[model samples]
Target: MLDVKDVTRMFGTKAAVDRVSFTVTGPAFVGIIGRSGAGKSTFLRMMNRLTDATFGQIMVDGTDILALRGAQARAWQSQCAMIFQQFNLVPRMDVASNVLHGILNRRSTMQTMFNLWPRADIIRALEILDRLGIAEQAPKRTEALSGGQQQRVAIARALMQDPKIILADEPIASLDPMNAQIVMDALKKINVEDGRMVIANLHTLDTARRYCDRVIGMRDGRIVFDGTPDQLSTGVARDIYGADASFNESATSTAIPTDATADRVYADAMLS
Candidate 1:
């Protein structure tokens, strides 16, 4: 379980995330949607402690994680893994080593310095890659893989931490439509199969509706809507996106059809 109470982050005088409070139970896929300047990214960062919340209580189970310090704080971070837009892998490094890096916080200084990973860690990394359907890429340099594959490697690295909550900041924003679907599907599978709670910051409304069990829409640093996917109607989306009537909701969708029939439907919609 997770509880974010009155979470707020201020930049000098401006509040990026203001008085945001929400509770997320175990093993659900939650999507945070909004326009460019909404606090979605900042909120995810705060969850992973990549960015500090000016004032808030972030509770996991019954404890306030925000109060942790030193090794304790680092342990909290290890349990709450972050996946970023840029993959964040060492390009020249082999994929297995990159995933093994996730456990550096728990290793001795000399072990990390010499890049010596325990046999158990390496085996677990391979297992995670296998589960994500990228096991074959484990021996290849991360840079040799395609964009979609690299993102999967990043996911494997996150899994290496055995995180209870996975926070993704625009995991698919840089990918093409097809690749976007793949990454989202991977996150969904992690939530369903591995029982990991996932919170992703997404710009595409259609993708959110397809994959998210719950949707939280942010506007100008505040949550404007919080409900299930079905509750997020077109009108509600417009409010979150600040879109006027001229905004065709489909235009905001990043989905691309894989079948011929669906492709025709998408094409016709474009023509119409």
Candidate 2:
């Protein structure tokens, strides 16, 4: 379980994350939905100590995350892996090498600095790539892959950490509709099949509803709503995104197509 108690992050006088409190128990695919500068990214960063909270405590399981220092802090960060919007892969490196980098926290500094991974770690990286349906691309450079594939590689890298939680910060904001759905499906798979908690900062309402088991709506550095997808009605969405905001056609509707149909649509979209 993760407990966030009165967590707040202040930049000078401005509060980026304001006295937020929440508890997450068990594995869940959670989506943090908000418009730009709603403090969603800041909240997620604080969870992994990427950005320190000016006040309050974040306890993961029985340990206070804020109390960890040096090696312990690095270990804690490994357990709570993060995925970024930019993918963050080395453009020139092969996919396998990129995934293997996840084990750096567990490796000696000399070994990591020299890029010398053990055989077992190499095998594990390949397995993760296969599991993510991109094993064939292992030999290819990360920059050569499509946006969706690159994102999957990023996820594979996170999985290699064997993390207890995965925090994705607006992971699919750069992709097209097809790629977005694929990435969401991959995240949902991790949450369901691997039983890992996935907390993503989602840009679109439709993607959040399609994949997340729970949705957290944020507005101006505060959590406005927390509920299941079904509870997030149009009025609530309006409240979250603001009344004058315009959404895509699919955003208002919650009924998404089956996986097979979604793939077909993607194929067609690509062809067109």
Candidate 3:
């Protein structure tokens, strides 16, 4: 569904993303994993046009996304929902209203300014909350929810657009283990049930290996490994994280279950 060819982003002397090339052909869950400064987040941002790439091209379906401007770009971006590590919910807004934010582009300036979403829009937002298992909280202010509930609200908001692609940049980075599992399960359910293309930048290889159909490993801005979780060998993990990678036998022996799914996904990744 998305094609990135030789994508490079540079800021003066520093190169954030370098010659990254990859493709997503259908509704699949894909994970982009790397250590800090590896450019995973920058690459995701480029796809959403949050930051313009210094060079290279990103195509959605068949359209060159970078070529879109103004209204066109906004329209396309609305179809590509972004979930951040920090749930960026408006504190004062009700949960349903926050989710409705996804459709801002479709509203008139006056309608949005006054927060007057159409009745149908409100119904749709409530339905999304129900599907996400947070319907009861819809009338509550965002500030009244817990972190996990807040993130779910963020996902509900993203779904309100009926987005074709979902980009989650470290969605579980701030949560505890149980909450992380809840969030990952929600994402996995969306991918499996709705077949929405989900791409996430994850800090732990465990999550990627567990939930992603394929894992793309990055190092110093280039793709070093890309394949199924089962195809990823110990050697590959070593290469991606060095000998001290957290998923090592000793470090991961006890926490295996929490990361088992990610381990399997990475293990299944192709050797290429």
**For each predicted model, how many residue pairs clash, with residues at least 3 apart or on different chains?**
0, 0, 21
The RMSD of every model to the true structure, in order and in angstroms, is 3.3, 5.4, 4.1
Candidate that beats the other on lDDT, 1 or 2, i.e. the better one: 1
Candidate 2's displacement at residue 29, Å, is 1.0
Give the worst 10-residue stretch by lDDT in candidate 2: 247-256
Q: Taking the tens digit of each residue's C-alpha lDDT, what string does model 2 give over 1-272?
A: 98888888899999888888888899988899877888999998888888888998998888989878888988888999999999999999999999998877788888978889889899999999999899999999999999999999999999999999999998888777677777788889989999999999986666666788899998888889999976776667767766542433323232233433332332233334
lDDT of 3 at 258: 57
Cα lDDT, model 2, residue 55: 92
True lDDT of residue 48, candidate 3:
89
- Window of ten residues with lowest summed lDDT in model 1: 259-268
- Candidates sorted by TM-score, best first: 1, 3, 2
Off by over 4 Å in 3: 244-272
**lDDT scores of the candidates, listed in order:** 0.84, 0.83, 0.83
lDDT of 1 by residue, 119-161 (tens): 8888999999999889999989999999989999999999999
